[model samples]
Target: MKTLTKEMQAAITPDMALDLLKQGNARFVNNLKINRNLLQQANETSDGQHPFAVILSCIDSRTSAELIFDQGLGDIFSVRVAGNIINEDILGSMEFGCKVAGSKIIVVLGHTKCGAIKGACDHVEMGNLTALLTKIRPAVDEELTITENRNSSNPEFVEKVSEINVKRTVRSIVERSPILRDMIKAGEIQIVGGIHDITTGVVQFHEVESL
Candidate 1:
């Protein structure tokens, strides 16, 4: 696989960028990863990078965007945070990645069996992590389907909150950032959400044309 160049990044459309990720994930699942020289790609992208997309995913070790997407260096920008929640700093980073960096799409990626989500589900509080989990409270509240057992031990409840959190993050990005919102409205960029299955390594994407 070749490293992404400025010209290649420019030529890629939002849908095309998404398709590239889908294809990459398929390769990951089938263990048919593209072979590329890391040193060569690093040397080629030393001067500058023109990544096609910016992915906001959880800090889970199993849900690495680059590996799961089968992307080479400079192919995509990966932003990681626990629970994949949206905040001012994260919005600014996404703005920089898309508005200033010429990325075509933004993805809010969540995953199954996420520790952060579990923490939020159980209201785990530990020093700074308490503040971080506070951001995920809305998602936990939004998941009203499972009122009986809304704690972390209940796997179904945790999974439901996880999905809601990704979707909420996807919407919160556009609602929070005017630069990204205008870009999305003008078709310059696209936003979507996905849930990564740790066991299967399959990312089930939820499409949101505008939100």
Candidate 2:
């Protein structure tokens, strides 16, 4: 309901940040969103922002992290890419968000029925996008359970690969960024994964913690 401030951000622990996200998503799914004046939040955060978490999610039009999490402006830092894949640039941004900007949590958010995951499952290629989808290919290969219908059309295969991709991305963040890893090791931050079901408007987080 209120915009996140410097003191509020500093007071929140990593686990508490994750819990806040879970509670926000629950409010979203149940249509119990809190009322906040966007203009007031925008003005409050105009000079600076002290977001508590950094969310890496998909470019899917339906999976906007703020909307689903019911967060006001300056509540969290959002980074988006197809398949929620990780790269050097993403790692740097996350490092800045946590190490420099003081965010307490890093979330690699994948979504069900993701088009990028589907493309990776089928190896869809195009200008620029081919390279982007290639990052998700490893997850597709790692999903050895669904060997029968290995394409995107098979809902099961897509779902498995999507979850795998999120987990892999979570691992990648910790392994690729020493700043983030050190922060996590020092108990200053946490990295986790989740999947957003498009139909249900629900974000089901994975139990595994990549700290």
The window of 10 residues in a row where model 1 has the poorest summed lDDT is 202-211
The whole-model lDDT of each prediction reads 0.92, 0.92
Write the residue-wise lDDT of candidate 2 on 7-85 in tens digits. 9889999999999999999999999999999999999999999999999999999999999999989998899998899
Report the poorest 10 consecutive residues by lDDT, candidate 2.
202-211
Measured against the true structure, the TM-scores of the candidates, in listed sequence, are 0.98, 0.98
For model 1, state the Cα shift of residue 184 in Å: 0.3
RMSD of each: 0.8, 0.9
Stretches of candidate 2 exceeding 4 Å from the true structure: 208-211
lDDT by residue (102-175, candidate 1, tens digit) is 99999999999999999999999899999999999999999988879889989999999999999888888878
